[model samples]
Target: MEPSYILHTKLKELVGVHCNLAAPLHFLGIPFYRFAENTLQEICIKRGLDQKKLLLHLQESQKQTVVPSYQSLSKSSVDVVINHLKSTHMWFIRYRLPFISQMIQDIDSQLFNSPEIAEDMKIIFPEFMEEFIHHIYEEEDTLFEYIRKLYKAKQEGFMNSTELFYLMKRNSIKVYAQQHQDDDDEMAGIRYLTNHYQLPAHASPYMKVIYSELKKFEEELMLHSCIENEILFPKAKALEKAVVLKLTQASKLN
Candidate 1:
């Protein structure tokens, strides 16, 4: 749909034309089902979101043909990258995870003939979900919080001697980046259990939806890891070095 048409189109109509719009709508904090009766412009106004930018995001989300890139975001400020990452986490936690969990619960075990697959779904997937949530918490509380501190230190030029000393002795972004590993293996067990999400020929619709969403979730996880490890981490390391250098020069002057 053209941007002009989409702006005026009711969300339900737009979603009918592009079913994939549902995910991006949810990600943008727009509940399509609740606002199905409203036009995109109305929803934007109600939500106080910039309509043009929201339209651009929706259009980009519809490009199923291309792999979305965060390369440009690497050039963004540390807070900008961190904020985007936090939003991604919110989407995962608030929408995607719950959606998948409910679908998993709704699956008819009898359809799976294989007890092993059922057991894996009941046990392994839930465990993985718990671990994944914990990982997000750890990053937010530890890694991301530390990065914010580094950014502040850089921005303020390490003026506070006590704060500078505290930061210098605290966990450095360089150290964290060196130790950080992309959790590609986090979903490895589940992927192996599901045979890479290959559903049986006789798989029911519910089972199909589960596998499809799971595959998409795994892909999103890989992209999230790439952004953190490749983009955010490198820039953070540079920021840390700059702050430390400023502190050293200040010490020399003192």
Candidate 2:
């Protein structure tokens, strides 16, 4: 959020995962730091980006000022964000996780190189997958569906608004957001087992391919969490709060 950081640091160096923001970053004409010294709200106002939307985004930046590379994703409609999230869920659960889980099955005890790798591969990877799958289920079955409906009700806020909003009120975004558990331990084990994903000289081709695929998976996973934590959850929570307040006020009027 500071002028020194924005002007000095490369955009990708700060938050580029799978997303590319180079072209758009360059779009903010000369005098880039004209309002960088101001609050994020003021900077957005000065730069012509939506202030309210960016505020929700910065909240999910691991509490950092370095605006995420997928800031454009934050400005997308709720339904667009939800669809992207669901598709990512499918990619992880149906494809990526299963593929990685199977690949680890043949971790050669003989050529595993490091004893640390051998032990963690057997113990840690399996544990991480089990917990990872569980986390995905919580979102797919409960949270994603709720968010879809919540966004829908927020959009079509009339005929059955009171009832729909009341149902949302009972369930509450706080409940769902609170369920957003930390997944660092799972990825941490992967990093540890792979020796920071650096393939060894004597490693087989299969091991190299597997490690490469895993790096892709890790990048995808980071982008996935960013959308939910930064964009979807905050917008959904705000909408839910507004709906509840409206319902309370209407009840008082009666």
Candidate 3:
């Protein structure tokens, strides 16, 4: 859609035609239930978002065919990788998970007459969500924190032998990467439960939206894991090695 047309179109009309816009709009903090009547321009103005950038994101969401490459990011500094990972973590926690949970609840309320699917979702999704959130917390609190310290050590050199020894004793990036399992099994359970997300012949529009969004979420999760395992961990391990090498040289000099 043209930028001018998108700016002028009612969000309801736009989203009706492009249901894929729903998650991106939610990520941009535009709740469709509340702002469907507004034009994109109006929402942008009210939300203080750049209309051009918002339009571009929406358009890209529609047209994007491949997962974005993280090859360049693999060469980026540990701080850059950490920041990108943290932003993805925030998006999952603050936007995607809640939106999916709410959608499940909506489906449950509407599907009480035929509650099997909804009941399965209610039982399964929350368990997956809880584990996912805990994983995020552990990364931020332990793994990311350790990486940051390695970065600091590289930048400042170790303050003392004890500081260096303490960091060396901590779990290394290699260990974390080895222990990290992608969401393949968890998402497989969801896909299996939803019967490969094949919509029933009589599935409602809302049901279709939930299934579509869940599939997208699964893709995003896979990409997130790839970035962490392939890019973040390698860079961090290199950083750790550099810090250790510098400390070793200093000790030899002493």
Write down the RMSD of all candidates, one decimal each. Answer: 8.0, 15.9, 5.4
lDDT of each: 0.76, 0.60, 0.78
Itemize residue pairs with steric clashes in candidate 2.
none
Evaluate residue 139 in candidate 2 and report its C-alpha lDDT on the 0 to 100 scale.
72
Q: Which stretches of candidate 2 lie over 4 Å from their true place?
A: 1-71, 158-166
- The C-alpha TM-scores of every prediction are 0.72, 0.62, 0.74
Query: What lDDT score is found at residue 38 in candidate 2?
Result: 44
| Residue 120, candidate 3: alpha-carbon lDDT | 85
Model 1: residues >4 Å from true position, as ranges? Answer: 1-69, 113-115
The candidate scoring highest on lDDT is 3
- True-vs-predicted CA distance for residue 187, candidate 3, Å: 2.2
List the pairs of residues colliding in candidate 1. Answer: none
**lDDT, candidate 2, 1-254, per-residue tens:** 44445434443232222122221222333121222234334455557886455434433432433422477778887777877777777767776666566656655555445646665676777788888888778777777777677666667654364677557756767777666644443587688668788977766434554566678788878777777778888888887776667667767887
Model 3 gets an lDDT of: 0.78
Candidate 3 Cα misplacement greater than 4 A, ranges: 1-17, 21-69, 109-114, 182-184
lDDT value for model 1: 0.76
